[model samples]
Target: MEFAQALFLVVAGHNDRQEHLSRARRLVLKVHLSASLSEGESVRFLPPIFGEVRLIVHQFLDRLMHDSGRPIPIFNQNAGSLDRRMDKAEFDRFADAYEDQHRENIAVTGEGPEYFAEYKIKAFREIVDRAGIEVNRICDFGSGIGNSIPYFRRYFPEAALTSSDVSERSLALGRQRYPEAGSCVLIENNRIPVEADSFDVAFSACVFHHIPHREHLTWLRELHRVTRPGGLIAIFEHNPLNPLTVHAVNTCPFDENARLIFARDLAKRLQAAGWASSRIQYNLFFPRALARLRPFENKLGWLPLGAQYVATARKV
Candidate 1:
């Protein structure tokens, strides 16, 4: 098929304003798939940007197909060249569901911390500090609505920042709210679009629980691929051991389907992904009523009953 024909085939269903962008992303994915399969043999035939865009689309398609319980059509084609499973209708449903919800409710102001502050951003900062990450390049993986940007900046102001997420709308707002970010990537899949060994410290807060358990390691490997040797990977998740955390996620609109992961399980996933010296720390030991107790909470690191816990490991 012609390039235009393939692009059109990839974006056939969408008739909205985003159809153009939809086609663009698919094209990136196609070119990326070709280059990946052909290796350097296809470099002369494709653009350099294909390498980056393919990672995003490949990840995106994996999520969509996995969710739809069907295979996406893109892979069946020569460019993707995998299986013959084709279900555009199922793909559309998954795509729509993946879009951002509660856009207005998730906003953050430059004057104050955003919605995540209630979870004690200070504890997250403490985890990064404890990880001993050098203040250089930082990647905020699954950076929903850019809520983590402010805290990341506070923790490593001099570090170059990149915020990545699946929802373009969320990323758009993230860029608007935090212009200091050098790159805002719209990630559709488990893979991060950045180059390998690109980040000094990579962090994701409350993102993994949203991902299916089966895909966790795949994404972790992606995180591992992009992180520099000896770089820190910090993963923060809701503590399933905490009843209050369960109640909150059950009630939260965005988290209706979230499966809160335990600290040990997450730590194991990190260990299996080739991360070394893995350490887990529980934080947010106090409710807002006991906010004053946060200071004392630091000394209670021995306790793993906090509302959330951060799993840190070095990419060795």
Candidate 2:
């Protein structure tokens, strides 16, 4: 890593007294997946801008560190993965029931597609900074109404952004809101209808949990194929350990706890697929007990901690 890149990562990796970074950095590998790089891929230009870009990530960290009054997200043990011991159709139907009931509120309100999207995009900007990533083709894996498109346009404006969704209705709604931002371009490409191993970054947000556990490996491996060697993929999910999150899952739309997959599970997922684990960071600190301590969650800061987590890895 270049001096500037290293500096930016260390800063982005920071939480408390730098000891947090010691733990966080273990999640964010200073080590690169050298074999994943092809002859044309080199870290030559990864330094200067990396530092400037990471400044954005630090700003995000600052905001997330502040305790939000909401209960931290929880792992909905009820939610099933593709590796189903339970009914796959029933699992999806349960989640879809929530989606169907409050389609408008869920899409336009609550976290406001843009709210979560903006926060998540900022996080990825940090990952790209550390990964020395520059992509020509990108996939917004859980492309929700194109909220993530702006982030890609701002950073990799020239790259083709392929937005995918299981539901066309959602994409249509997305186009209506963010037309100029390539919400429309997504339809021209394929999501369920398209071939695999196509795009560069298989950027996902809050979508993996909906996928049954059995299919996680296949889905990730397919993502690995669409990109060129050494490509980067970032996965964003709620932290099960957070406080307010617990409340959101039981009371909210899905009636399923946001499946907060542990970081260890995340590591196994990446390592199994031949990708080197680069950086996994904890964003929101939403402690579970804070559910009852609502008024105090934000004030205590250190009390109910971290409901959001991010995993950024490379496809080797």
Candidate 3:
């Protein structure tokens, strides 16, 4: 009787150990699957048997998920790659869900993607109007899906608008959205497919940050080459100095590889690229909570605390 009781206890203990291991495996697999589908959350709980090995398991899972052939959520996909350039292929992947991702990322600002797009175009128009520049032809450089097309049409109805981007799929979507655009040019080999001195105004909305810093001068020079002498080159970019802007970029899936530039730094880059009379003006000073204070934002451009900044230069 004593021997039988001992045997029964041992077998039951073995079965319980097996069950724990099975449960732990299922939990790890669940976490791994979730990591593949979305940005992973913190691993807080594990089977008690894994007490000492919990940290090791976490590290192993991180490496495994990173190598799983998909973009890791909230992390730059190029972090481990040799080539860190944000190329056409990367943007092409983002083209389909660009607007939805953008809208979600900027939801904290209490505005839609369209609002941001329209505001940048509106700011560009105001800059040219103040300078008394007559823009007959406009180049929407880096015009992803032509988000600014409608606003461009609204602001400069008479100007012939040409949109350009590195991503073919984005251009396809843009064409679908706005067939009335004068032209959609594909950028190949890091070159804008247009003749020299083709446009009176070359505008880029929140595009430079995605570009590798080494290539900024090349594109800037390209923009300079495309714009007519004395024409405007206006660039809108997120201001890194703004905490809110930093948070927005950090959370934005598309901006995972973004390298935000200071307004002053962009001005210097513009000068080096053969642009003259470069100036930086900050905007979007107030969130929706302070909508009443938006009228005062224009006056605050010199403060450098706005969510974004527009760097404008003349091709002289």
Candidate 4:
């Protein structure tokens, strides 16, 4: 229909085809080093989203002289009405569909510790692991469809878990997928739904960045409100330095978009929320482009703003 819509379809179609995911990762890695880039690289190999989408589709289809034998999945749209760029109510509407899409993708993609190794999930896992604080109670603040829920359960089977979001539908999906436990609780549309001074550790995965900076402060406040006075709050957010992040924030392809965020700003917001970082880690050190490069970015604490930022703060 519209240019952005059609463009998204082309890109998404290629992404849906499992074979292309590896190619996409390869290209992403290739562009990382200037020495690695091909001089006469044909733009044809580029994803359809790289150029005018409809034109790419037409040309590609004609070139094939028939269907490409690839079945494209339709785009998901529960968050079309929500604007993460807005100063308020970001991701409220879209979380359900967002969670659904990602949950399925993870299930399909996860082969082992490195399944979809090039993606962001592995980074989140590392963040959760390093934030190492044990508590009887756990809370995931922006637990989308419970992707983080399963990860939490996998790591912390003994702890009681709580998952909450502003979107009820998203929370419902988390409930559906999360292992049933007599001790767990699922909450929706309720900020800081957990009891005050309750949890020993509270975390949000791949969230924070989705909220506009204005609302980001409030999220920090809520993180503080729910945890015990000295409990820990961990936030694993997107890598600001990633080229894909720049593209998505500028052109997220749907009516909704991701808001731009940086670690310094996140730290400032945390301070404004009356919290201070006990431990801050910038993770997923090597950009997917540098997969061949050893010692991922976080291994070098010298560069704090390298990729993903995971901050564990104490409630103050």
Best by TM-score: 3
> In candidate 2, what are the lDDT values of residues 132-200, reduced to their tens digit?
877677777757555577777776777777777665555666566567665333322222444555666
Candidate 2, superposed: residue stretches over 4 Å from native: 1-78, 81-113, 183-197, 255-258, 286-305
Candidate 1 structure quality by residue, lDDT tens digits, 5-36? 53344344333424554555566567666667
User: lDDT values of the candidates?
Assistant: 0.63, 0.55, 0.77, 0.52
TM-score of each: 0.63, 0.58, 0.74, 0.59
The whole-model C-alpha lDDT of candidate 1 against the native structure comes to: 0.63
Q: How many residue pairs clash per model?
A: 3, 34, 0, 5
Q: In model 3, which residue pairs have backbone atoms overlapping below 3 Å?
A: none
Q: Of models 1 and 3, which has the larger TM-score?
A: 3
Better of 2 and 4 by lDDT: 2
TM-score of 2: 0.58
Whose lDDT is greatest here? Answer: 3
**Which residue ranges in model 4 land beyond 4 Å of their true spot?**
1-132, 179-190, 248-255, 287-296
